[model samples]
Target: MNIIKFSAQFPVEKSCIEHFKAQRDACGVVCPKWGCVHPYWLQNKLCYECKQCHHRQSLRSGTVLENSKLPFMYWYAAMHLLTSTKKSYSAAELQRQLGHKRYQPIWEMVCKLRDVMGKRYNLYQLTDEVELDNAFIATLIAEEEKDKPLKRGIGSQRQPKAVVVNESSFVENPKPGKKPKRVNHLKMLVIEDLRADTISKTVNEHVNPKAELTTNDATPYSKLFEQVKSHHAQAIKKEDLPKTLPWVNIAIGNVKRLLLDVHHQLTNEYLQYYLNEFCYKFNRRYFGDA
Candidate 1:
């Protein structure tokens, strides 16, 4: 939603709390300890009481906001800004906007949200035709490597290997200036190495076994056929990437630019969280301001 709509909908902290409570209620609160789906809302305590074990859990007990002391409005506002924009706000920028005094809490909150984004996307597998490729995203050198001699060129800095896959469906009818395929869902996974087994494992987990796959004739993708029904691996030139593996290439380029533009220095530990936010927004691009 737009700023005006958001402001009108959640003008006060109570409104945000009520909306969150309604959403939690619709989803049904489960007792994390006992896995009890039914829970009674204790008005006085503002928590859910499990009838089965007489356990009381706060509203945010099992959610991303479990230990967060931030106001409900802050979270609602953050969600709105993150979803409503084409790009994302850095934790520092978000903290400035939220008027928060400390940086750690806001950063943690953003990272937690991004982590959940990855988890939510993990529930679904990509189907039909997909293009797979690997990207080396620049990252901050490890503590041990910080004092070591730097290598030349790309190797001078630490770059994390990421497996990028996107579902692309062929469009029978050609629109003027449009590509032959349209992208659906996309996934990016950071891996230790770009070995055949590593790439294969990522594909098997995220892509449906029945889906047809396409990739450049990279040696690491040699065993991709074992994971999917069809594997089309061909040598692709730089100019022909638009026709060969359009969406995956575009996604890789866009994400790299996004990270470079927003968070200049990245750590290997949190690289996946950054990727998760990009993929989450890309997947929901059609749902503008939702």
Candidate 2:
């Protein structure tokens, strides 16, 4: 939805509260201690109390908003701003939009929400046709050296290589001079090493066992098809790609865009969190108005 419609529908504080209540109800409430059924109490107008344990729980008690001192309306506004746009905003930008003088609290809040979004979604499992590739991300190591020469290797480098695994599912219309359209479901993994074992383990963890894997004639992926039923290796130069594997190219393009646009630098320690966000957004790209 656009900003205008979003503002019109969720203008008041009460409306935000109602929206939260609806989401909370749909997700259900359980006794925090024993995980028992906790039915909503309409009279209370906040949350359900556990019948057996008698534990009182708020809708946001155990969620990402737990212990948040910010107003519920503000929280809703922040969520709306974050999810409403395809373009990403830095903490500074968010702070400006939020009209807050302090940066730390707002930054922390945005990071927390990003963390929640990271945890809430699952990656697409490639089952029929899959494309696999890897890319390196150049990240600044220090604040002082942010603008230092990167190509000359002057600044400390954090090479967090990412693996791109995509599935051909829903094909879009092909453009002129473009390869055949393939519906691609993509997942990116940030790992320590690109060893055969590491790649294999990552693939096994994310993709289903029945997936048909496709890759360049890399020795690491040569024996992978043996584990699954169908693994195809195309002997193409690194520069030249096969026409059938349009999904791989698209996935790579998306990764580059994300790195250059959304996240400027990613350290190995926090790479997974960023990848989680990317995967969540990619998976929900088609969930329009929902």
Candidate 3:
């Protein structure tokens, strides 16, 4: 939803609380002790108490907001800001928008939300035709690993390796000058190494065994056909990314721009969180106004 609609829906703290209560009710909160689905809402305590077992569950107990001291409105507002934009707001930017007193809390909140986004997508496996590629993103070097100041962009030692995959389909029309293709769902994740076992394991984790994999003729991916339904590879240079794997290259470029324009620097420890946010919005790009 847009900022205007979000403000209208959650104008006060009570509104946010009510909305949370309704959501929890719909999900059917169960007592941890007795597995009782029918729980009593303790308005005074702002928690649900099981009638059968007397076990209590706070409103935020099972959610990302668990143990958070911020008001419910702050979470709703943060969600609005997150889902409403393409290149989502950075923690610093969100902190300013929230007008919160401390930067650490806001940063933690955003990271928590990012963590859940990754979990949400992990439930589904990429199927059908998929394009796979790898890219390097700038990251801060660890103190133990830091030897020299690394330059920005592609060949830097300070950059981290990431795998990019897009659920793609081909289409051709006689009226067209060239073959047209469509791509929507995308996934990006940080990888530790480029070994064949590492790449295969990562593929098996996120992609379905029935998927037809497509990639450039990388040495690690050469024998990947044995594990998947089918594999297609093209012998091409790195510069052919835009022309060969259009969607994935576009996503990689966007991520680079997002990091360069928003944050001052990214560390390897939290780079995956940012990728989660980007892919979450990217997968839901067509869900607007629905």
lDDT of 1 by residue, 120-159 (tens): 9999999999899999988898788888887765345588
State the lDDT of candidate 3 residue by residue for 4-75, as single tens digits: 888888999999999999998888898888999888989999999999978888999988999999989888
TM-score between candidate 1 and the true structure: 0.94
Error of 1 at 14 (Å): 1.0
Q: Cα miss at 288, model 1 (Å)?
A: 2.7
* Clash list (residue pairs), candidate 1: 1-289
Candidate 1, run of 10 with poorest lDDT = 150-159
What candidate 2 gets wrong by more than 4 Å, as runs, is 34-48, 142-156, 169-175, 242-244, 262-266
Q: Which parts of model 1 have CA positions greater than 4 angstroms off?
A: 32-38, 151-157
Clashing pairs in 2: 170-183
Local distance difference test values of all predictions, in order: 0.90, 0.70, 0.85
Better of 1 and 2 by TM-score: 1
Error of 2 at 233 (Å): 2.0
